[model samples]
Target: MLKRKLLTYALISGLSFSMGSSFVHADVTKLRLAVETTPGDPLNIMLASFRDTLQSSAEEEVELEFFEGGALGSESDLIQLLRAEQVQVLPIGSDIVELDSNFAIFDMPFMFADKQTARDALDGELGELLADSLREKSGLEVLAFGELGFRIISNSRRPINTPEDLSGLKLRTPGSATRILAFEMLGAAPTPMSLGEVYIALRQGVLDGQENPLSVLEEFSLYEVQDYVSLTNHVYTPITLTMSANSYAELSPDMQEHVISAAQEGAYQTRQLSDTSDAELVEAFTSAGVAVNQPDLASFQTASVPIREAIAERLDAVFWEQAQNILEPR
Candidate 1:
């Protein structure tokens, strides 16, 4: 009787151990990431690099699942999922950060001088400061910051060489206060819409124009709908790789290090892909018979000064000043 009892006890213990091991393995093996861009877009190309690198380097089996091109819903929806720990990671536009208010700094028009300047700002001390601020304020971990390239204007109407040209033109913009104010300051009627709707809206003449990076413009085939592409470079946009604090806390220390490292590497690669795609997109637009023009950027800059001042006023002078300090030569 004693022998039989021992055997049964051992069997139960063994089964419990096996189930625990399986649960641990399952936790370590799965990751779900969301991105708003299509699979072939530069953003996805960069994410693929991260996915590959993480799979190769992790000690445990790792699988990355991507929800792309609004298949997972809009950025706002994804953020909610991240907060709920349903989604593990999101590569989202800076505009999405406005939901947290602290991320509003990135929306400051002409805040970044160029791509290189923006890269330096985000990858340097300022980037760390911003990332830390975001983690503290929003309960999300910013693994890495990347470039979406500078945003330019694409319109079905005449080329916008000066602020006057934008007058009365209905322009589609992201649902950020800064974006709306920027276009409003420039005298254009800014319509806030989801990116997925922009292409259709433009096609149906619901919007006179929209703004985005060259890669985005090309990805959505906006070139086919819009006749004029103006290199306004009005806003320097950054793409952030964000993870839920709850999800991140659940990772083992080793896994956490691996995840952050992989994201940083992916961000660097994505920036390169974005740069290359920007150049290629210009050619693609030209080939597609879109009239591309490099208008004097000075006019755009001059027009934005008042808009910046207004934003600074609303955000309080100190916050705006600190942001400027971060961008200034150091």
Candidate 2:
């Protein structure tokens, strides 16, 4: 199955490049988009929609070639490639916060009451502020915001019903400093690791558990190694659709418009897919023998208050306030 998936993308890359080159009469704007995630992940889903929309709307004016499943390397390596213009676009994960701490605003635990509230902020000024900061700091232009969705903790140990339930469990988290601190405050020993390494670690007893959206848990097959899931709805992670500044500047104005509009469409599609897919994915986990529970978030939220204050000064003052205004409870 994995071999077939790789061969499919290889054909896509070759065909896209050939189509772009064969347009002798008209100049084709070629863009390379890479991601560490596999084809069916939400990040790739958004990019696939973005690519198709661009193709249909622009009609040979633009061609997008994908290098997915970490073909180019980790998200960190991909960022360096974007800066060097080796790749034109990427759907960057929370590792982006490492570039500019202001992006950490999205890493706050229990920040949004629901996915809709998170979408409202990402599609509004709060998102704009972080995007502008990213451009200034790293020269990547943000096109749209998609999601990694709200994360829930799953473990091999026990069903987590409260913050106390998390005590001393070595949980695998993404490489986000704020996220690490958030888990620590909730009483878990957070271990930072890449998604690709998580399954073996869980199965071999190197990790007690990890947190992610249900889609990710299913996509990565992490549920196979775990026994319990606690729907803490702990953090809402946004994947930023970004283009290299060099690539954007080189595009004709009309082509740039096509890219941006297509990105917005893809972003909306991802949110809709995530909203609908969770209910089904949850059942799949239960059927696989993984116990599931939706714990009351009040206790988790209470434990996270001090961590919020701790990271407050680490973020941009203005951006922090704006984020709170958009996502904080009414």
Candidate 3:
């Protein structure tokens, strides 16, 4: 977190949550986990596994309730819930940067050379650094870094074979300034949109396409609307499964350890899903009638240099250099 224009968690304290909310339980120490990903998405799958793992290991009676498919609202809504102590945990995607700009470093185009190196960065000190920043800035407990994997572009218009191919395409991007800037440098007309609005926007021709991991495409039914899948791998995003520190601090030490261990289990499941699906997802797209192409990744990687460097420098030159050091060669 840059420490400039910071939004404090205290802002959400005055709000009241409905007692009848499905995610809350009275008899047991219940953990409510919120996610925007559709039910079958790998992140959700990991969350479900986490639920089982935590409940089984917990010393006392515990329950984990999940709100998926944006049922509890957007990622921003979940953050507010965390602040209000209405939810115990949240598996948030890259949009987390909206709360802390330095989180944008995770979305910096081509931040990790490959999935393993990225996992190493996150599972190691780099992950702890971001966790410390999150706790310091927002009063959230970073359970573990969840994976979003490599982002690929999909379109209904033309096949994207090169950076030039993206020109004039109405590409839908997350609300990250760094991402928008990277796409612009690559020549695409990037439109910042929420995930909930993306499918309809693509289906109705309002959006030429969108970018996400392959699992998102299948889980969200993007394949039905988008005709092409380009392995652009423009960004590798690691999401966070975070808890409200206030709620966490109230737990018994034993329960707290169980929760922490379960989160690690969830992280493992998340990474394992990506390792197995990276290639299978492409085959899935092809089977679903989406034309898949391996574009000249070098072209997109090259286009990202100036924009990524500028964004990284503006964020933190020292931290960025440190991130580079932690990176394992692809």
- Among all candidates shown, the one with the greatest TM-score: 2
Instruction: Write down the worst ten-residue block by lDDT for model 3.
Output: 2-11
lDDT of 1 by residue, 1-330 (tens): 476456445544543453342222555657777776787665675666678778878845576777677665567666665665666788778555564555666666777777888898888877887777778778888888866778899999898888899999999988888778878888899998888889899999999999888888877887899999998787877888888776777778888888888888888887887778877888889888999999887887787778877776666455456667777745
Model 2 residue 175 CA deviation (Å) reads: 0.7
Q: Residue 279 in candidate 3 has what lDDT?
A: 87
Please identify model 1 stretches exceeding 4 Å from their true place: 1-29, 59-61, 316-318
Listed in order, each prediction's TM-score against the native is 0.87, 0.90, 0.88
TM-score of candidate 3 to 2 decimals: 0.88
lDDT of 2 by residue, 1-330 (tens): 477457545545654565443322348777888888897899888888888898899996776678889887777767766676667778977788887898887677777888888888888877888888988988889999998899899999999998999999999988989889888888899999989999999999999999998889988999999999998888888889998776687778898899999999889888988988899988988899999998978888888888878878789887777776765636
Query: lDDT for every model?
Result: 0.76, 0.84, 0.79
Instruction: Name the candidate, 1 or 2, with the larger TM-score value.
Output: 2
Inter-residue clash pairs, candidate 1: none
Flag the better candidate by TM-score, 2 or 3.
2
How many clashes (backbone N, Cα, C below 3 Å) per candidate?
A: 0, 0, 0
In angstroms, the error of model 3 at 74 is 1.7
The window of 10 residues in a row where model 2 has the poorest summed lDDT is 17-26
Candidate 3 local lDDT, residue 165? 96
lDDT at residue 75 of model 2 (Cα atoms):
76
Residue 102 in model 2: lDDT: 88
RMSD of 3: 5.0
